[model samples]
Target: MAENGTGVVEFVLMGFQLQAAQGMGLFIVFLACYVITLGGNLGMILLIQSNPRLHTPMYFFLGHLSFLDSCYSSVIVPQLLETLGTHKMIITFERCATQFFFFTLYASTECFLLAVMAYDRYMAVCNPLLYTMAMTPRMCLGLVATAYAGAMVNSVVRTGCTFSFSFCKSNHIDFFFCDLPSLLKLACSETSLREQVIFLLAFLVITTSTSVILVSYLFIIRAILKIRTASGKAKTFSTCASHMTAVALFFGTLVFIYLKGNMGKSLWEDKIVSVFYTVVIPMLNPIIYSMRNKEVKEALKKVLRRMKVS
Candidate 1:
């Protein structure tokens, strides 16, 4: 028998490892962030839905991205809020596994969605003549469906592998949520193969999606340079600005957290960085899109005015 217990019934989420007072402070801050994440993502979705002008493929993908961000934040942030309160954070095996599965699903889906958006932008900017015909509503729906399917497959594989192992080693999870990386660390069985698989999956998701985005940008930039007028080029570039900013923020944080090095040594640091993707980025998306996208801004204004009038 160990000092803690013989068998682990539930995993104790060592979320943030802050004092009670500090936890309370963070709770307030994260609560505000969660509210913003929900509001921003849902607002963007409704804004896109209501405005007939936003019926284009760009807004179509943007609306889906916002929905993913909202769901992603929802999966992690509410549990995080619970941990940030006065009580010790404990999640049952089943609930933790549920969290891990859905979070991965949403995260992976967002990655693929971003790549698809980049390709859409590339075609729109570089091959505007064929944009409407090629990116038809049917094709757009197929792409979104494909993204969800990929995420689901990956999530099922990961969660099944992760929970298959016994956790007699320790029940203390070092991160806020039951992420694959953190959970894998606690496994008593052979994790070398599982870790390799995870690393490969990470590489495939990050590299493949990032490659698409990069190549799409290359063609887009080339097309812009060929535009003779500076104003026309600026207008062309402006179309991609929000997505580029979003990609930079999302993938930048993702690369920093996963690829930098040694997650164990910087688990605490990684937790902080994790907050950006899980909480902050969702909130930032609508603001970024609304600010950089003139159409979205106008749509938002019109929506607000109608609400006020009512």
Candidate 2:
């Protein structure tokens, strides 16, 4: 194993302090969640790809969101499962860093991507006639590309700064995975500067993306209100319902954990919130979108009918 600054080659991940029965129960539950997350996300991607009717800017972004959720959950959930099953898990510094890097990358990208999706909704709802012109295939690709590029830069900096601290003390991380706040507790060096830097970057990302979502939704709501009939307003609002629900669930937990007042103080609360966002949300996204979306439902029905005939 490669020595990371302080000759600490590996770190022990303390999954959760629980009795045998509790651990076993959690293991089963989390395993089920992981399976569903993978299946649902992958199915969403395939369904979108298979249906030409779903080939719009909205579904294009949704397809990528499903992909990111799959990868984001995969990065942390497997290690989390191992830790929960074994009670403790050992990870080399290099491997831990790798996991952290990818986790951050996928997560940050999703934040920006969600905002992009919101903007797509705004255009579709508020400027239906111009949506096709505004959200062209090339423009959609560019937006997704920009999200990935920005996230990559953030991930590189966070990984470098976080792992740079010398870990001269205990190598045991109290949390299941290699997260920033949990890992920071083990640092022997001064973390104030790096903490500020990390926080600033996180703040910029969360706030900027949040601004976009809020502003887009503001316009969306206004446009919905101006519709001639209640049915018209409801129909237009329904299209944004799924995306709004997703944004609330995702950004709610994110804001609570990362951007709140008592950050890192409530480790237990943090862990619970972390589990929700990391484990449960991925499994829920495909369900939320497919169930609320008429187009996706119709496409799924068509697929099922074709399968039966064969």
Candidate 3:
């Protein structure tokens, strides 16, 4: 702790600790990735908003997801780039806390939002007759609002509990960014109970979200199986391919990295997986959706043609 148990005024992020040449190389690579991630997500959102055909509840949720991805990636990547560039990775206490708050907020928001998308897919497939009536604009708006509200509350609770511990010993954070696990590891106080609470909440949150998605997909599967024609089943399942891929990548990485409750694992493999979810996923999400869905490709074509004409 810095000042009578108040904690350190700032943290020094030991991000990768590579040689100067390697650090610059990695910086260029990540900087390029960050730019592409921003472009892809922003483009997705704009295309969704501009195209009349994409004004449905599905696209509405997708647009919001793109927005969140853009923001979420931005939260961590800029500082990471800075760390790689200058080799002095320092973050003040207040700034670190703020970054952590928004990080949790967006991460949790994406979790719930993905679940909501799964539910939408379920309604479209299993309850096609009532799909339009079921997902009215008001209802869609309310569901999106609930996702944001729930995530915001969860972020607040977690961030509050995390910063409550005092960091007396070292100010060195092992990771590139201000993540919860690294922050917890730096604290001088006993954090067993806090860790338990965090683990329980993470368990509940991820389990509940993934369970809803799984159940929705189970119904979707049953409904698809009831179809007599193979083509019909193929078409129905295609609608979910993009979302299913995204959910898989997301949940898979988290399960690998943190399911064992070993966030303090400073292995290079762990860092790579963390980068997969935090940096790489944002870039991949737009590509996955755009590639799997014909509608998005058509929308991009229209947008490009209009741009050329203008």
Candidate 4:
């Protein structure tokens, strides 16, 4: 076994090296993505906060989702940008653990939050008479709280389990950040138990949330079909189209990366997949939600007008 602590203080991340010859170009691209991710999510939050008209259950959930996206992107992107710029991919053990913790937390929370949003839609469309009472402000607060709590618990479990294992090998993490599976691969001890635990957790979260969202949407579709007016159906569907797109993209990338065996994939391949969930999805979320929703546009205009007046 390698010396316990003497090998290296920091693990070097080998971020997208396939296009290594064009380091400057990749840096520029990621920089632009980071900027847009931050600005878009922040703008959404600001718009929702400033507009009284947006003070409803749907926008309430959206505001929190935007905030989570901002936090999620911020957790990974700045470090990634630095790696792209300097090609110095060193990350300290403590920093790596912290990054992995928050990344897992926010990612898991997003899964639950998306499910909650689907439930909100289901209630609004399928149980119109009881929608307000069903999705009360107190209920909304509780749902958001549960999402965060679940995320924190999952983060603690994953991070605690990963770090508890002894790391006597080389400290080089092949990817940009301390991803759970990559870090697991480095542990000196056997990871059968850890793998089992993680797989179970993944199954529980993904299957449970996906099942709920799917069932809710089934009811939503039935209710939409019952609407006699074509325009009414269109309007109702439009409200959820953005969310459905987001759910598809987010879960698709997640399953591809985590559910599949990471058998022969290169670190470069892993980083590319990581980009979809870590960076691209968050950047696209605000645009998808805002562009598709008339209320958000009106909120934006109102906020811009207020800013101009000030």
Candidate 5:
């Protein structure tokens, strides 16, 4: 069976339509989500950058996380809004491929970054005396750089393998965006190579991140147990809670989307899961971290005071 390059030049995404009546309502809802996502992530970035109090290694990592979320949301939400508005869900092949590439890149980068954050918490909690030495400026920079590099490599490999496959049949992508699994089903050629590539990449990235976070927390828990005072334990747990929540939410949806059996699932199923990571999580990240963190609150206040004075 050779590849089928038939009449279709582009794909029309059927984005979650229960009925015509609900389209307007859904559009309004997602539009609000996009606005909040943009505002929250950008606000956190500005807050971290402008505040002298937040110039530490932790805040430095956080600022980058916010930036990543901003880019991540930008890649997905605008197109989603357009789809909602015009009801013209058509995306060019090149544009769809580019969307998947960057979306995968930033998402993978965030996974690694979250692992780094777990390690940061572990050191800060477990080895407070040596925290400065362990997590130096150079080390932080190196960790962040590694995250971006690893994600880029993964994106290149995945996108290359996907695009290499021949698209012969119906060009209409069933989902709202170009996702690996959904796109794979549309390939007219044998997807043995692509399947193997996706499995390997998913296993490597997910396993490594999960292991790092688990090990780091083990050390963190051990250190917390060694603390004699109740107040001290309470304080340490408080510091880690927000990050743990974020990690759990992120990896949970990720695992469900990618790790499920490749059964007869529709593209709409994938799109719903994609929404969690693409739209909802980005909006929630800053709210999760900043609203709960003392440092972020203090930094915001300081920044506000400075602005008022200036």
Candidate 6:
């Protein structure tokens, strides 16, 4: 409790609330996932840096995406593992706020970066002559930096707004992590302003990024349609298949969690969806890219051969 009896000093996270046997089973499962997420993301980063063939605008954005996914998982999974182990976990007010900030920052940055990647693909496929000139190393870096900067501003504002509200209702958060919807439900003060601000920021980030991706793909699809040969169309579309998959998986979850009208109505269902995006998505991204991308697969084969020789 806070000194001003109206506020909560800490929150009790009622995690999945599984039985002892189920909790231990989930702990092992989540631990395995965390390990794979780290290995896959970090491995993707190393592969990109080491392979000269991957020294292109697309791979450059991908390296950052892998880094973001790694950090995103790190922000939420460790605490979730603890919660699964104990069936409940306690987080201080400041700690919970910190988690929310970084989580928002990484997630928002990823949303923007995916859009940037879609544009990168558009330049390559829809405007091949200008691709090299348009997406230079310097330009790519500037776009990535802009994404990070925008995410930072959104995170700072959302975190400030969310924490500024009084949590006098109860200190029990229904979700595993310090998610915005879950925390907002515990706010005792009038949360209309905070909710509005959070919603507007979220709407802008998701909508703006989604719009960019949709437009980029439309242009890309037009270009593909103009190709005379089936092989040419397949090759051009293949370049973007992995990115399309990633965007759908990432944005689909965001739409369901943040944009839905029936939030806080189904806590159990929310937990499952949250786990899919936070825990499983990170582990799947590298796999998706590696499996769908021939260049990445070839690069992995070369690296493996070198390891065997050494």
- In Å, residue 252's CA in model 5 sits off its true spot by 0.5
Quote each prediction's TM-score. 0.95, 0.96, 0.96, 0.94, 0.93, 0.97
Taking the tens digit of each residue's C-alpha lDDT, what string does model 5 give over 215-297?
Answer: 99999999899989999999999899989999999999988888885623665667777888889999999999888899998
Best by lDDT: 6
| lDDT, each prediction | 0.88, 0.92, 0.89, 0.84, 0.85, 0.93
Decoy 4 TM-score against native: 0.94
Q: What is the TM-score (0 to 1) of candidate 2? A: 0.96
Q: Write the per-residue lDDT of candidate 6 for residues 154-250, one digit (tens) a residue.
A: 9999999999999987888877889988888888798898789999999999999999999999999999999999999999999999999999999
Please list the residue runs of candidate 3 whose C-alpha ends up more than 4 Å from where it truly belongs after superposition.
Answer: 1-5, 264-266
**Pairs with steric clashes in candidate 1:** none
Ranking by lDDT: 6, 2, 3, 1, 5, 4
lDDT tens per residue, model 2, 1-310 = 3355465789988877888899889999999999999999999999999999999999999999999999999999989888888765899989999999999999999999999999999999988899899999999999999999999999999999998888876788888889888788788889889989888888988998999999999999999888999999999999999999999999999998878744466788889999999999999999999999999999999999999999
Could you say which candidate leads in TM-score?
A: 6
Candidate 3 residue-pair clash tally:
1
**In model 5, how large is the Cα lDDT of residue 112?**
95
Task: Encode model 3's per-residue lDDT on 1-310: one tens digit a residue.
Answer: 2444477888988889899999999999999999999999999998998889999999999999999999999999999999999887888888899999998899889989999999999999988899999999999999999989988888888888888888876888888888877887788898888878776767777887899999999999999999999999899899999999999999888778667666744567777888899899999999999999999999998888988999
What tens-digit string does per-residue lDDT give for candidate 4 at 163-264? Answer: 777666667677777887777767777778987887778777887789889999999999899999999999999988998999999999888888887623
Q: Which tens-of-lDDT digit does each residue in 1-310 have in candidate 1?
A: 1223334568988888888888899999999999988988898999999999999999999999999999989999999998887565889888988998998899999999999999999999988899899999999999999989988988888787778776887888888998777777777878778777776787788898999999999999999999999999999999999999999999999988777645747676788889988989999999999999999988989988998999
* Candidate 6 TM-score to native: 0.97
